[model samples]
Target: MHKELRVAAYAVCVRDGQMLLARWVARDGGKRWTLPGGGMDHGEDPYDTVVREVEEETGYTVEPVALLGVDSMRRTHPRRLGAPVGFHGLRIVYEAHVTGGELRYETDGSTDMAAWHPLDEVSSLDRVGLVDVGLALWRERPGTGRVTGIPEHPADAGN
Candidate 1:
């Protein structure tokens, strides 16, 4: 078995009852809405990662206002050659505010389109569990910087 650890950052940017989201392109050719963030680069701070990722995916210059919470997830799945791989992910979530930039789609990237969606309609969209987790952290602002009760899956996110 192969073991892997990934650290990433995400942002929950909400303004006037609308949340910013990016359309993630899955390996199976499906699309799902997700937060505007991604993995950290080598030697990169998670704070910088969130700012850079949000710009890349959503075409917005954002300032992380507060450290929302962290979500840790683990899973094991078979690789292409049938070898089992154990994956652990640490996601740092932030409450971000958009400062500038225009809405645009990411070209040849993990996400396709960027848009603002009404918060009330988020639950009805085809989305990954991280979306809910980020929202939960944003809404509850848990003291431990953690959230619970959301269903997570390996395929729902990646670095």
Candidate 2:
């Protein structure tokens, strides 16, 4: 199987009518916005991974406040993973509250800058598709369910 099981987490932090996001160039040379979170190390807790990742990427300490939902979607695409590829990902989304630290870009992470982008402006910036899903889960805090029948690629690309 060419599929890799990837586990990741993300935080939705809203402040002053804006959402704090990590802006970086995705591997495809497309600028994308995402919550400050990433893959978890084996034996590491999802909550801990979000905290560690956010600190590393956005220089903010966050405490996960709610379990948004789990996205068990299979996504396939060319050059998806550093090269033409396919992927199956299980992503854990969470609602996090800022606890400590200042907002700044940390070079150690993939993002070039950490800042609050107004929610109204989200559409103007490039984004990973998951952001909308994350926002949905964040808004509803749906628990323990799978959003099924989702296609593995951009809807327009195929049947």
Candidate 3:
């Protein structure tokens, strides 16, 4: 089994009662809406990672204004034949705002589209866990930089 850890940065950008989100294109061509961000490059700071990822995925220049919180999740899934691969993701969340750039779709990238959606309608959208976690941190503003009360996954309901 292969095991790995990934560190990522994500942003919550809200303006005019809407939130900026990118549609992530999975390898199988399915899509899910998510916050505008991605993994941190080697040797790059999380702050810079969020800025670069937002521009890459959403074509919007963002300035991270505050450190929101952090989320850590782990899962084991199939990779090799009947073998399980373990993965852990440590995500750093930030509160950001658009500084410049126009809305555009990311070409040849993990995300293919970006758009703003009404905040009240987010619950009906198919989204990744990061979105909920980011919003929780933004709304609750836990000074400890850790968001609680949201379940990480369906399996976590039992924990």
TM-score of each: 0.96, 0.81, 0.92
Which candidate, 1 or 2, has the higher TM-score?
1
Off by over 4 Å in 3: 80-82, 153-159
Full-model lDDT for every candidate: 0.91, 0.72, 0.85
Candidate 3 per-residue lDDT over residues 1-159, each given as its tens digit: 698788889999999999998988765566888888888889999999999999998888999999999898888866647688787888989999999999999998888889999999998898877789988899889989997777664331101
Model 1 alpha-carbon miss at residue 100, Å: 0.5
Error of model 1, residue 75, in angstroms = 0.9
Query: What is the full ranking by TM-score, best candidate first?
Result: 1, 3, 2
By TM-score, the best candidate is 1
Clashing pairs in 1: none
Per-residue CA lDDT of candidate 2, range 68-120, in tens? 78876665666534454456677788888889999888785567777888888
**Candidate 1, 1-159: lDDT as tens digits:** 799888999999999999999998987788889999998999999999999999999889999999999999988877778898898889999999999998888999999999999999999999888999999999999999999999995567463
| Candidate scoring better on lDDT of 1 and 2 | 1
Best by lDDT: 1
Q: What is the lDDT of residue 151 in candidate 2?
A: 33
